[model samples]
Target: MSESHQDKQHKARQQKVKQQVDARIANATEEKGLLLVITGNGKGKSTSGFGTVTRAVGHGQQCGVAQFIKGTWENGERNVLEKLGVEFHVMATGFTWETQDKQADTEAAQALWQECKRMLSDASLDLVLFDELTYMVTFGYIELAEVIDALNHRPAHQSVIITGRGAHRQLVELADTVSEVRNVKHAFDAGIKARKGIDW
Candidate 1:
């Protein structure tokens, strides 16, 4: 069979893209720890962070996770990652609206932030994930300045991932890579309850 004109055009476009990508790759030489932020009103923010932690673990790198605003429910990631030596700290207070206790939520956030600080300071850990941390900062439970300071002082080789909706502007600005997961459509909006293994 003979090649079509459309096939030739596609090949030419791909060749051009390859050259552009190759040039960018050649120009990039620096290597260091990165701060990544995953924020928006969509689902899967924490899931994405956990996926990154899993990737690091696969590489035999030490990782830590601090989950804020999450209820004291069973966590599949914690169960698997802990066995791989990843330290995890859960707020265990659930959502703020559910608890409806400002004082207690603040107290829990502070305690969890302290644990996060320890993880950030640990040079042995290659990656640290702060899941749903934006709520704490926005709710005034944790100082944004303190979070920024801790991130700034973290070891040069330690990468960090922050996942939550409504991330602080300052935090977004500081992040090397920022991704916003927009909610186009969700099963919950259609009256579908969140499943255990899939949703959690």
Candidate 2:
């Protein structure tokens, strides 16, 4: 059998792409901590952050997490990660709407912020995930300047992941990488309730 013209063209295109990728790999030599901000109206923000934490753990890296607005509901990620020596500090105050207590929510946010600061400063922690942190800032429970300052002063080799609905512009501007998840469609809108293992 002989190769088709389409196959030939495909191979040529792939060869060119390979050359470009190789060149990029050769030129990229810098390695440092990365600040990744995942935010938007869609779901999976926390899931994405947890996936990265799992990756870091697989690589034998130290990881920590701060859940700024999570409720007392069971968290599968925390259950698994905690056994892997990943420290977690959760607000456990549920949603602001449910709590409906500004004073209590603010207190919880401040406490979590302090823990996040400690995690950022710890050189031993290679990766830290601030889950739902944007809510704290947006709700006026935490100071944006203080958050930025702590992030700026974090260990040079410590990477951080912040996940929430609405990320501040300042935080996005400072982030090395930012991903915004848009809500195109969701089952919940169709009267589907969040399942225990899947949704939570």
Candidate 3:
């Protein structure tokens, strides 16, 4: 084909794509907080959740974050977000495997859930990040029904992001936006330990 004809065809195809994208953007006009779930066995679940929290902070929106399984770690995201005056809480006991006590893990999870509820009830908070919370339900540390109820009853204008692996079926069903991050590769698979500031 001639160069001019190809250019015209390219322009036509691009115009069609632009129109479709414009229609999609125009059709989504409703304004409200979203219950977004980021789940899978990938490496970026918590990272993506924290990224959303940072975005909210960039917009001057209030954010609340509670790290369940990773409470004991020295985290870069927590350092910056807390420095910026975002409501952040961390558990000192760390992961359940480290603790190795089912009862204690359950108690700590309940306490964290109370903190999550406190943030959920706060209408002023624009976003809440429940970090590594999927394990709480999956491990039976907290009742799934309670979590569902709390999420369902959250303030109309308050957005929430739940990040962890193996999210409950009900949660996937309930979420307005559900993202499944598939695992393609990992540094751990190559025998490299998790690096600080990047992994945590």
The CA lDDT at 136 in model 3 is 92
- Model 3 sits at a Cα RMSD from the real structure of 1.7
What's the C-alpha lDDT at position 93 in model 2?
91
Candidate 3 or 2, higher lDDT: 2
TM-score of each: 0.95, 0.97, 0.96
- Pairs that clash in candidate 3: none
Model 3, CA-based lDDT: 0.91
lDDT of each: 0.96, 0.95, 0.91
Q: Return the top candidate by TM-score.
A: 2
Give the worst 10-residue stretch by lDDT in candidate 2.
191-200
Model 3 — which ten-residue stretch has the worst lDDT? 88-97
- Summarize candidate 1's per-residue lDDT along 1-200 as a digit string, tens digits: 98899999999999999999999999999889999999999989999999999999999999999999889788999989999999999999888899999999999999999999999899999999999999999999999999999999999999999999999999999999999999999999999998989888
What is the full ranking by TM-score, best candidate first?
A: 2, 3, 1
Report how far residue 194 has shifted in candidate 1, in Å. 1.5
Please name the candidate that would achieve the greatest lDDT relative to the true structure.
1
Candidate 1 has an lDDT of 0.96
